[model samples]
Target: MESKALLNENSDLVLISGMCVAEVLTMQGVFTFSSMLPFFFEEWALDSIEAGWISGIYYGAYMISVMILVSLTDWLDAKKIYLAGALVTLFSCLGFATLVDGFWSAIIFRTLGGIGLAGTYMPGLKALSDRLSGKVRARATSFYTSSFGIGSALSFLIGGLIREWLPWQSAFWISASCALVAFIIVWKLLGNYPNTTGLRSGLRSLDFRPVLKNPKAMGWIACYTTHNYELFAFRSWIVAFLAFALTGSLGNLEIQPSTIVFIGVLLGMPSSVIGNELAMRYGRKLVVVSIMVLSAGFSVAVGSSVGLAAPLIIGLVLAYGCFVTGDSAAITT
Candidate 1:
């Protein structure tokens, strides 16, 4: 894998290490707010739909901002955009930590956080992609994609721990601090690319005509988008669903909801890495279809059995989490 070769060189090793650290550190902010959605609903007396809007607004901002921010990578060094993204994340977290009072305030702050994510995640991928080539490129991509699972897992774990031991604001503050650290890492390790300014400047006049003109590429993008939509909805609601399952007979079961989320998401990390390897050995199309089908069936089964025993429900959730994320790297690769 180019991953190993990237590490074999001392400078490339430093850069890759910095990228991973920055990725994990900043990504902790992405779900910190969502994982605390129940608290907001309770404290602010928000209805389900309103709460959904607050979460959805984040994606709205991300979708709009990423189109521009990600494209900037072609015109400039991705590292610069990443630094700006980290700064945006830091400010967004700080806003949530200290300034939120109601739905509107929360929406404003959360949307900024989403925009920050747009800057970091895909641009980081672009930076990595620019550095690798050949079969090794796909393998290295899998590793980077897998780390997103790790980032998400840690976010849930840390948010839950902070909510238990301190205040919710503490979690936000800690996430903000992590974002600052990510900015520093990128600043120190990532190279500036003044030489490449003219390379894609012409390519910067954004036109999706070429992308629309390519059926194969468009299909892959569509499939990936569908996968993301389902995956994100599952992530956002799994905790609430588990909490509801508590009212059935599982209330006495001794596990926090976020713990389940952490376990489910953490388990997904290795599943993504291993799943991509299997896709490489077998066929990518076959593996993607198999995983998507498996996850869809499991999701249906789990939904129908929400009233079942907590052990059964929790078991299904963990299993579902595995299959749900198993396709992530493979599809993206």
Candidate 2:
């Protein structure tokens, strides 16, 4: 009975791995702009403020699209939203690869890409959650959550590696291919699960009054907001910060700033998975608060390390990156 029950719980392994891979693939183009920002700054003759908008608009679009589309998952099949988002991701990458020429065009496609991500990310998570329960569900969630870090690292590493031989646009083309593969995977492998909490007639799907009224939920929401602000800001600027800091010292380094960013983000995968385990064993509030405080201290130390040795600065950045991602799955769960 124990073995059979274990097998039953693990039967969704295909779905779990498929969704995780799809998530990773869908994220391929996310950091394309950030990884290639130096080239864009020169090619488009963009001022810092304009460049900031190009970076900022992606998240802005994501914020809006996720609120609506993820909310809709309560009523709609999450698989459908995931499919739509994957399609959008493919098109957005293709659009950016072939058509973007200047600042405005870049912004438009980045916004579209953001929307595509909004569709896949939470909706896909919802789909996965809807299909599983118990310890299997927790482990599956951690696996899925850890893929975001892998995807993020690949976003930087892939673009940087491609740009070594091919043009910058080639990275986007590859990213488009990844999205297409993700779309196909989900379309073929992910089956629709019934929404247990069916919406009642005349009631809104997105009504958040109850959520807002819950102080515990509200506290988590506030914490998540703060987490996102710092996380995104770090991702958006880490390469640039490294690039600027490494000026006159680039010749001495074996790795590029983008590679360092990749390594830093890659560290986040283990951090997230292990952090989730720790949160489960310890207390969530205790683990989260400790990680956040440690991350903030690292942030300060990194900022002050401008005149420090390159290796030391990079080490601090990697440590900071780990803590920055440590509490992610814990918070959401």
Candidate 3:
């Protein structure tokens, strides 16, 4: 019986790993679309404003979903919620792959994808949190969030390669495949872990008055918002910055923008782990605040330099990766 119990425990860990991979793939599907926007706009004859809307609409949808779904996480089976989110992502990818022919079409599909993302990201975190404890929980959350970076990096690199060899639609098709795989894995591997943390009782009573009134929760929410704004702005603009900086320095060669972004992303992979370890050894507040301040300072320096544009841009990438992701590990804790 003990041996059987150990085997079950190992299987549970494997399931968690699958959940992590699926969540990452779905995230990659949403984020990689940004890297392909330049090519997409030209192919579909979309204006810059329209392209911006395509991306912005998704985020808007994501924001709304988070506001609604995060509150419901405690009431729902997290695995089921995750599975539903993955299915939505798969449907969104299918729409993007087949139905997107114009600006409005792209916007609609992307927004759908965003809704799926909203459920996947936070709920996935909650799911992992339920299954882990203490230092292990901290480490798992770090890995889970870092998977976002990994997924984004892979999306850019793989999308670029597909665009080189085939049509841009191939990228969407690949994303669809990933989403389907995620759905399958999540369905098979993840068991229903109900939230027993009194969140349900509180939510059912509609007594968020206490949670909202809590200063510590409010403070963390504030920090998360600020951090997200900075992180999103940098992510959305980094490829453009890299392109401009490279053009100025390298004279508009046929170098891939995605490749450059991938390089910076690769450099950032260790950041979350390092940050988590630091938080464990030192303190979460100290580590998080210090990294945020460092990121702000580096952003200023990078924005000021013109002649040394490429190096400055690279420095900014490294700083953003190090600081933004460094603090990210603490947010879940």
Candidate 4:
């Protein structure tokens, strides 16, 4: 019986691996675009504002999609929704790789990709969460969320290496491949999660009027929105800030924006696990709130320019990485 239990646990791990792969692939698509943007803008003769708009459009579309799809998760078969997301993402990548010729075209393709991501990420979480017992669910969620940080880091590293050797288009091709691999892995490895269909129908039957009455859920949403705002703002601007800050002085250095981004991501890797462990040992709310306060302080330190600006920035970045990830796993839980 003990051996059988261990085997079942191992099987669960294998199933969860598909979720990890899907997240990594999806994040690779998003992060690689950011890394490749400098080259893409140069090739297309677009200005920074235009490039920023293009990035903004993708994220905006994704945010809208998440708002719509998150509610639908109760009504939809999570596997089916997740599969649809994978297909949408796959096509979006193909569109970017083959059809996007200019700024507007790229924006369109990226927005589509974001829509696909909307279907993939949250639904994937819902599906995985439903499979575990309440006692172990938080632990499982942490593992899943940590995969995103790892994926983002790998995407930066890989995107930098790819750009070093080939054109920006090659990065899209690589992203597409990663997505395809994830699609295949999830299709084969994961079994249908039970009770999702009834849950979906019940959600569909409701008016969605009473759902917002729950102050707890609303507070959670507020926390999520605030976290996303801070995170996206930091990530979107960090590369540009590095370029400005490191210029002239770092002319002899082999610093790429992607490399710096990867370093920050690398620093973040342990944060998720550590945070989750702390949450398990202490309480999730206590751990998350404390980390958020620390992260906010680091954000301010990084934003300030004083005596030891460079070192201060690096120290703040490390701190930010550590605390930013602290809440991620808990959010899903």
Candidate 5:
């Protein structure tokens, strides 16, 4: 009866939790960096690949920390880890605001922010999973993941506004404050749930041997990895690509580069839900493969046709963005 009551009450918790996750994730968009990358190229004396490294290092650090943080969820409560991660996010954003003048400094702080991401993302999902079971769990998970898309869109919008209107440092300061808000939300709402208090002793090794022995799971993992590589690469560079494409042609476009990126990302939220439904109707494997192929093909056209009309380039980007994120929930489940 108690559990049922809690489950009934959880709609609100899920809403708040999702929002908290969004706030934390939005911190990653400080200064609308992706949109600003082109500007930094000559100013910072950075080449393309070096600039890519500043972006890539975040995920690299995230990959390193996520295994440990998610592992700790088995022993420590997810909310506890989440709160700690929010702190890391807060400080990292602050660091970026004050410390970053060059590529190496940006890498250090962005990597720290990525660690904060490792803490909140999977662990927030874990926290949600631990609470809801059976039918409602699916909805909760979908809602939470979808919220990330919405949040990223909001970040682009907010960061663009701040960066355009004020000094770049102001955006990072606001982003750090967003992290603090995330911390407060999670900390205030979550108390220790039953069985969540047990502290498992010692470190548990992350053994991939068992999963590697299973070919089916390995295939899915491989597919998901490739899927993310393309998805993130497109996202990381899309705004800059659009801005570059608009050189001497800004008057021909309806939207600015950042706004286009925002719209592209925002539109993917429902597309993901719809794509999962389509996957169910057809098949997961079929839907995922088809989307990836289409996105890949479209992306090549986008790359080669940078000199095309701004609207055409933006349309291709929006289409690619939709397909890129469409299978997100399907792949996760």
Candidate 6:
């Protein structure tokens, strides 16, 4: 049986670890645009709104593609979807690195990157869940989900360091290389797991009536939508805001804005994993509400902290990052 093949603890550990690493590597380009926003502003002569469109278009493409790609997982092998996504990411990063010269080109490549993420992110999560059962599945879910923060943090840190040392295009090249490695890891290592659901006959029908009728599910969806809006908006603009901050007395600070953003994002991985554990112990609703309130309070504090000492501003933003991702795993679980 499928569960029999998964009975070995060592094999299970290896599967979980491989998927986590692939997920992290696949996200190498996820925030490359945010890290290099300052250079683009100067080179492209882009206004704030135009730059936002370039950055925001990634999510727009993701939203459209995720629905189609993840839904197909019911009929297709998730491993296939993941492999395709990794290849798409690799090529999209290459395109951005080699071909992008202005706003329209950046938007085109960023959109492709988003479609690539749509194929991997949730579908990869689903693949992991399908192979494991009970408590092991729950713990693996938290680990896999938290790894996203690791990927995002690395994108900011590595992209920033590369941009500082080499040309701006080098950052995308590095991101492309990571995606290529991710493709190899999954293609060579991940074993296929077939879907067991009996509803395979209705492949053409993607009826949403059942989900829409569930008040509890819809309520959670509403909350998650709001959470994502705030979190992504902060991520898309924080580096630019910090760069602006440096024009003041804080200009002499040793830490780069991208490094600070990296620290803040890296801090979120532990916050997400630990928060899910706490929710399992106490109660999901109570834990989620408390985390949301804390996140909101920190957001306000960070906004009010402009022009303060570098350390103080950095502290507030880092705290905000922690709270922003704290409830992610819990909410999804």
Off by over 4 Å in 4: 195-200, 203-206, 306-312
Q: Give candidate 6's error at residue 168 in angstroms.
A: 1.1
lDDT of each: 0.82, 0.88, 0.76, 0.76, 0.75, 0.87
Residue-by-residue lDDT tens digits, candidate 1, 1-333: 898765656565565666777899998877776677777779889999988888788887988898788877877788888888999999999999999989999999989999999999888877876776677567667777777888888888888788778889998899999999989987887666553658666365366688889999898888787787777788777777777776657555576778889999988888888889999999998998899899999999889876687788888898888888898889877
Best by lDDT: 2
Candidate closest to the true structure, highest TM-score? 2
Candidate order by TM-score, decreasing, is: 2, 6, 1, 4, 3, 5
Shift in Å, residue 119, candidate 3 = 1.4
How would you encode candidate 4's per-residue C-alpha lDDT over 1-333 as one tens digit per residue?
999999978877776776877788877777776766667667889888988887777778889988777667677657777888888888888888788899889888989888988888888887777776765667778878888788778777777788889766777788888888877877776687655458647566355566588888788778878777777666666666665665555545577877878888768867787887887889978888888888898888777743345555556666776677778877667
Candidate 2 per-residue lDDT, tens place, 1-333, comes to: 999977875668888999999999999999978987777788899988988998889989998899889888888889999999999999999999999998899899999999999999888888888888888788788888889989999999987788777899999999999999998998888677776676772136688888889999899989988888888888888888888887766565578788999999998888888888999999999999999999899999988878777888899999998999998888877
lDDT string for model 3 (152-197, tens) is: 7787787767777887777888888898888787777666775576
Global Cα lDDT for candidate 5:
0.75
Root-mean-square deviation per candidate: 2.7, 1.6, 2.7, 2.3, 2.9, 2.4
After superposing candidate 5, which stretches have Cα over 4 Å from the reference?
1-31, 194-205, 252-254
The 10 consecutive residues of candidate 2 with the worst lDDT sum are 195-204
Q: In model 2, which runs have C-alpha deviations exceeding 4 angstroms?
A: 199-203
- Where does candidate 5 clash, by residue pair? none
Clashing pairs in 1: none
Model 3 error, position 170 (Å)? 0.9
Compared with the true structure, the alpha-carbon lDDT of candidate 3 equals: 0.76
TM-score of 3: 0.90
Candidate 3: worst 10 consecutive residues by lDDT?
199-208
The residue-level lDDT of candidate 2 at 310 comes to 85
Candidate 2's displacement at residue 55, Å, is 1.0
